[model samples]
Target chain A: MQPLEKTGNILPLLHEIRHALEDLLATGQTMVIDLQAMPFAPSELVELKEILGVGEVSAELHALGKSTIQETAFSGAWWIVHFNIDEKMISQTIEICHIPAILMAQHADIQMGLQQLSSTLGGVSL
Target chain B: MNQLSLEERLRLHGVSRRGFLKFCAATASLMALSPAMIPRIAAALENAKRPSVIWLSFQECTGCTESITRSHSPSLESLIFDAISLDYHHTLQVASGDAAEHAREQAMKDNWGKYILVVDGSIPLGNKGFSTIAGISNVDMLIETAKGAAAIVAVGSCAAFGGLPKANPNPTGAVSIDMIIKDKPIINVPGCPPIPVVMTGVLAHFLTFGTLPELDHLKRPKAFYGQNIHDRCYRRPFYERGQFAETFDDEGAKKGWCLFKLGCKGPTTYNACATTKWNGGVSFPIESGHGCLGCSEPNFWDAGSFYAPLSTPIGHVAQNAGYALAAGALAGAAIGFANKQKSSQAIEKHEEITVNDLIKGETK
Candidate 1:
């Protein structure tokens, strides 16, 4: 396995990962992404699992140099990804793999419309 | 001689013809008897023979006396003095000092073991010095007078359960008449100031039957205190619909919703106030928008704050709480299943049991 350098531009990486998973789903292959090495929120993990139709993702904390990749089959194809990074590298990786800007921009527009409707109708503002 | 009609008997007894008729009308109304019972009441009253009486005033405020005096129909003058030979009443008798005490002794001597004793207060036992009427301790006076009486009528909350005087500290050590006079039959007509008609009604019942009316465990006449006020309350429909007045002058209050939430004690109080009412059947406290203070119940003053709600639980675990919801759910399910089963059975039994046959079977 080759080590992928963790980068500060995390959103681009996350968008690419989501697109890759969506393509893999269209090809009728199930995918499971192990987030054991990543410092991420459980709620975001749950949302990611729901979006990808993955079976399960296990999380654990351990010392450096002991990290390993466990391969599993999905619709007759085997795939795995593993990495070991310092705290700074982890933060840079998160920044690079955060949610996409286009989806955020769309969400902002929807929220703005909701706020206007609430103000006009005297209901809860978004 | 059986020679006098009711009108003639009244005349012979010094009750004028008009007074006798008026008494009959008042008796009929008080007893909730039909107007037609006037003649029967008249006959009963005419033959009553002025049952011997011994009136005792113990540790009381004399409010019961004040209340009976305000009766407009027959009036106190006619009811006490003429209707029955009031042998001894400290307030009403003209005699005073030793003369009054001698009269009481003479009346007891004349009608030994044959007079009705009317007690209007509690007995104080904290010390002999707590209460004394005419230089005699009330405890001694009550016990001495009660021994020779035929029956006893405790005529207010004071005499029934020591009333307000017995609340909390109860420094006087006040106790009801029932606590002292344990031998003879006792009837309690309890209220802050008992309704006048109820007092007279019990007297009339005793006169007519020659025995006490039916009584509850509290020794109150069951005819009057038999049912809880809630059972007969006019605002019960609003309670059934879950409507309640949250405050005294809210829209719900004006609309006459149940006063349960506003500290109404009617639900737990047993009395005839809701039905018999007060002030000549004009209106009771609840009718006037004030919650029931439950003045008739024993230890009413100490039964917690008068304006506090019943403190009953109001959810599924409450005695009858969630009953409507449970019943409706079960009934709806049962009806739907029964209908489905009936339709399926109808198809199977179509030829044998026609609709006419089913109707005939139902009738049979």
Candidate 2:
């Protein structure tokens, strides 16, 4: 069945992302939009992805689950989809930022790594 | 047993910051909060300690438990269920007989006045022998257990509102939790069997924020119950365009036109069915080519015919709409215009749906 256009949430979300991109440029702000918050008309999500297209940067993180981080065609817009160990998609989001926060190493993990390195080399820990 | 915060537990489980962020993002969405609040949810979750939950089941068919059990592992709902201390549950617990009672008593003693009490099924007040566990009446057990609870979560329509057992000719004199316990803060998760995500969402909110989420007049979480199904329905366009399916096997039905004429109660019923869906994102009743049974609302079984469309008079435009609105709302439904209307207001809002409307096949 075709969407009647009167009850469409996809276009409004695209507009919201555009506004978020502008906000990012003006104030150095970042934004995350939860794609699963609202129900989508069938195939609307696929249509959205097609519209955004794909960008060069795409990476996968293996933590408790497999998380795919890909930049959309729009430079600052990133699409991140996470799957549980069982391969179930837990969450999907669109983030507008310079670099998505999850891609960076956490400070606590870095500190622990540094301490382990110092102990391994018999050197003073910073 | 691990006296650690939720973050600490996830870290020990080898979950990284990224995984935790994914969890938070999913959780925020499930709780109907914006994605911007993920950081706050994460921060709050760092210090959030797991509270003990005591699940009490009575006068139930175990559909609520079945709904929760159907939830897959590692989903936020199942994850939170694992995170919390589910001290006593009759269906899942290993202990039985006196041993089971002992486990319940021990959990209550350990976390007295701080533990969460989750009760499913209605309480039969007429006959003490109507429903009992280990020679103890359901009402007695509920009253006794409620005394020390931090908050009470009435799960499913049976416990939240009087469900099937409390339908016409209700022999057991079954009444809801709110009717019995007025002292404690009760959060009603009403559905024939509530969506498992919503049940866990309430628990997640309590775990993260140390308080219950905002509730509507029916004591349901506004996040899930705030919008009626019609508003969120994909068939809404067909409904607004006045293109309705006249019969179950008609041309309009094949083309996926609105099912209002087929007695779909989507317009009157309020729940997260359209958005949350059921059986893990599979289609809901309306999507499956069936009218909503209005199961979540009170006295749904007695609210005229499920096959009868919500009647309206074509003669009076304003009068017919108000009458239709009040007819649904009178049963304590969250119909769009009059969810807050009093009984007197509902009576005043009522207008007649004459036989001529039916004769013309023009019921609204």
Candidate 3:
């Protein structure tokens, strides 16, 4: 049997993830996301967090209580986002469900805005 | 018209000629002075009158006194109490009650502006009632004693930087002698318990010169506190090569690599521990495979976690990564282009020369 191709376009999923990340960054709040049981590698999780403008990413080895994401996946695939201000973890399930194209565009715009802000404040590019 | 010889002078002070000369030699070596200075030291000491000194114990553990008392060679007790006229030390004085107070009072009255004052602890000022000795608050006692002192030597971290008790929250509001007595020239011999040799060296310098030695901004003698422990560290080569011990007994640690990753504070600590070492220059903490805790620097306790590595990005990774990649790519393209040019040139040269002409050239 032919391997089943991923049914939905990944661009829309990425856009949704990007919007959630932007909101989290702006508000400095923790967010829970569902990945819809899609399996992904560690590198994909790292790339997803980077693309979503998460600064420093660390992974936990255990599930946070009562979350919808599997304990193993949460421990293995969840990414902790770091900034000078704070650190927060993002669930792997949420990442897989929302890899949308508009999210990539928003990520670029946010990165550019961050660069401008850093340059203005520090008098040097970050 | 009779002046005693150097031997006679030393004998009058109860030091044998051999003992006096040996002490001169030791002093010369300790001060990093030329051997020729030994005779001068002997001569100076022979003619020199014993300087009056007043020992004050404030809010402290008496560890400084204990450390000094234990000096193995030419013990500090003999040097300060018997060798020089230590007029008053609350712990050492034979006088008691009113008599002890009278001795201090009389010493100050007679030697006003000439006696050396040695303080051994921080003065707690949070409340005037925090610490008292002999019915006098330490702050008030310190201020009163420091008034007529020719010079002040704060003998430990307690009297130098308020020490462990002043670490954080600082509820007692302890302060060093410099904070209270700004008018007098103060020399700080600071350590958990300062090196015995350092304590003697400062006193020797004063005894020989009748003044304080050159001091740093922190009022420390430059001779001992000038260089950072890392500058003279044996593991410095390992640090330079990026070899570090991840944990206490790990493989890297077994090989004696840098302890920086193990939370060594050598980088920021300035002290003579590495060079001078402890226990008569025998060994330092780093030599025994422990990272320096930077106990000598001010506010070291509050700096941060002691075991955390002073994290800095490794290599030129952040600065030259792009340049290196670009250079590699350019080098690859240049080599490809050169190979293409060489092959094309060979083809053109082969096409231009007939086989017969090539054979003719070889034959010729």
Candidate 4:
């Protein structure tokens, strides 16, 4: 199949996403762009990223294996990549929001950290 | 009576202010309100007095109540519903017999011209014996209850468009709420059982703005029913490219092509099922492999068979074809003769080229 036709024409989908992203930005709402729903070759994925460009903010999440998050040039848009235990690609998506939810520490995890810190401080001098 | 404010009730439910704000933001987005309106929505819902709601059930299957109550346990939608002063709901309230009738009367009297009147099912005007609440006929009860309403909400297809109870016969003479209540502002949220969030969303809008949200010609909220199902369908690309599934188990069906040829009524039907989805945004009928029944529209029962393709003429297939056939024959013969003469001339003028002529190109 031609490289253009291999992806089953995601340009229309991209147009829709762009419009939705604009609406999300305007409304302060978060939206998830599910890449799994579309058939995009590696080259097409790279092309999509290039078209969207990249911003300055990026983060690495180390909880359940390693996941990388990158922000696009668009004000509130982001790209997140998750990997399996074997470092194989698990899932990828373009998330539009003021900040992606993956980087935030859960309340339970924060409580655990607080408990550990207070117990250690109680034993130590300072 | 539940006297606590919405914010106080939410706090009692263990929902934080931030969580409540998030719910407000989500509600605003769903209603297509601006982000600037988020804070306003939060403020309104927070301190808003719980409006009394009198739910009247007539000729319904209890599906609308079921749909609105299908939210998760301790869900924001459920909490919002809990925040409302639902004074009388025959299906959910514990009162029975004369007590239920008294409760409805007391609610309407207490909150005269202030409470929201929610009606489900169609009103039968054929005979007073057709349907009744206590001893009052459905039509009489509706007319009496709707008199002092701030606004009437017609939930489900029955209340909005005289559904199955009013199908094709003249027996019951069932009619919608809008057909009877001409003085009051009626907001129709028509669906087989409307999306739960939509019901709550409309309530939120009214609570926030103190007025009904924008509605379409059918009195359905345009925010939820603005776009046609086909336009928002996931398999729309297949329709645009002329790919369709002829049968249930065909290759096109297996490949998840469009269901238009399989009697999908998505093109004309307008609803939010395709976008908002059903059962907690899981999947709608088309996604689960079935044609739309056009349940939200008026007189959908008489629309046609659910399995007949939209291209197929509904009532007079053979008669319409017979009429078209005679006209087509005359036009076909003339076109066929003209085509024969044109093709013969083209063939006579045709020239053959050798392999060397391919190198010579078109100029030669």
| Candidate No. with top lDDT | 2
Q: Could you arrange the candidates by TM-score from highest to lowest? A: 2, 4, 3, 1
Each model's Cα RMSD: 37.9, 14.0, 32.8, 14.5
lDDT of 1 by residue, B47-161 (tens): 6666767788888898998887775433422343345678788887898899988888888998898788999988888897788988899999988988888899999999999
The candidate with the higher DockQ, 1 or 4, is: 4
Q: What is the lDDT of residue B202 in candidate 2?
A: 94
- lDDT tens digits, residue span B103-197, model 4: 99999999999999999999988887999878899999999999989999999999999989999884799999999999999999999988887
Q: Score the docking of each candidate (DockQ).
A: 0.00, 0.41, 0.00, 0.04
TM-scores (chain A) of the candidates = 0.24, 0.87, 0.32, 0.87
Q: Rank by lDDT, highest first.
A: 2, 4, 3, 1
Q: What does the lDDT read for residue B250 in candidate 2?
A: 86
Flag the better candidate by TM-score, 3 or 4: 4
| Alpha-carbon local distance difference test for all models | 0.66, 0.86, 0.66, 0.78
DockQ agreement of candidate 2 with the native complex: 0.41
| Candidate 2, B105-188: lDDT as tens digits | 999999999999999999998898999998999999999999999999999999999888898788999999999999999999
Model 2 residue B25 CA deviation in Å: 1.7
Best by DockQ: 2
Off by over 4 Å in 1: A1-126, B1-9, B12-26, B32-43, B72-81, B312-364
Q: Give one digit per residue, the lDDT tens place, for model 3 in A10-73.
A: 4565766556557655774333343312222213444554554432332322111111222122
lDDT of 3 by residue, B71-101 (tens): 4333422443344568899987798988998
Give the alpha carbon lDDT tens digit for every residue of A1-126 in model 2: 544334488789899999999999999899988776677765678889998989989989887678899999999999998776777776788999999888989876677678788788886544
